[model samples]
Target chain A: ANDDCSKMLLNRCSGCIAVRKSLNSRNISKLLHSCPHRCDHHKIIVEAEDKYKSEVRKSFICNKKILLTPRRRQLRIES
Target chain B: MFRGQRGWFCGSVGQDLRQLWVAEGGTVCDVQAADFLFSCDASHPDTLRIYQSLDYIEDNATVFHAYYLYAVANAEMKTSVALGHFILPPASVQKEIRRKVGGFIWEQDKYFQIEKHDEL
Candidate 1:
């Protein structure tokens, strides 16, 4: 379980990590705890179109890519 | 007891229910009306009553927070500043003591420390 995501593997690519608002970054550990809404390999994201029926939990599938664009609050500092 | 230029008074105790027992040096009392902007006392029935009837600092510089003691885990969850003044409970374990002034940091005696390369 790492916080910096220095060695995260996403689709054989090494860098792209799922950065969710509740998750901050994809570095899951057994004893790791941040938001109660976060769990290993799964997240509950509301589908944007229908705000009412998007209550189901959704898993995020991501790939590692060299994103040259700047991101907001991208620096994930874990507790 | 007059506070000098940049001195801060600090001391706290843990109660049976993890309540922080504050002594005289704490802010709730002894602050001159001109010392603070606002203050808040949380739901400690007996404690709040005693601190209220007493005269308090009336200026805009006064502020108090009486939160569920253990409910607040880390202050960093509430801060986004690189360098600034804030009356916070305590920064996270990952954050190092970077600076100090005017208020009491939960732990650490020295005023400031930088983060990124720090340890608890």
Candidate 2:
């Protein structure tokens, strides 16, 4: 998988392809390996990962139920 | 006339533009080495910065956005069809492209005006 990733990077694969491949991988350490240079493809994958993490954080925050029942009720009611 | 020019294309339109560039005798090359950089979206920060630095008349390097190319091609096609000329001369095509670029610059100024208005 690391060899495949290196080959794809060398071929200058499109951002979408790179993002898909990176997202499909179960292990980041293995996929990223020791890439010599931070090329455009790597930058795209990093950006996508950051975006995904942020989105998950946001959703978790939104779903959190605090003890402020009245405030939470009002917020839900308003929406 | 792109007889000896080196060109590079960005975005999906690059493939189409590559064919056109080759047809016009231009060689496709790496972006850094290209005399002509054609992009579908010139609004990308890096491309925008390069475009802002270019002197359209004085600089040998030129960046052509896809909108300008479409406008030029559309006008050329219409003119050729109306005149029953299957193909227009290279000199005439060059002159038309220059005129279209001038118009495109004006359109870009209008875009800036709209952006400023939105900010205000």
TM agreement with the true structure for every prediction:
0.17, 0.30
Residue B2 deviation, candidate 1, in Å?
A: 21
Query: Per-residue alpha-carbon lDDT of model 2 for A1-79, expressed as tens digits?
Result: 3454344435442332232211211123223333444445344433333343344445445767323233212211211
lDDT of 1 by residue, A7-52 (tens): 2122211111322222110122111223344322112111111121
Candidate 2 — what's its lDDT? Answer: 0.37
Tens-digit lDDT string for candidate 2 (B18-103): 56567657677665556556654545544444333212111222444533333334454422211100111122232443343222
Among all candidates shown, the one with the greatest DockQ: 1
Name the 10 consecutive residues with the lowest summed lDDT in model 1 chain A. Answer: A52-61
Task: List the global CA lDDT of all models.
Answer: 0.21, 0.37
Which of the CAPRI classes, incorrect, acceptable, medium or high, describes model 1? incorrect
The DockQ score of candidate 2 comes to: 0.01
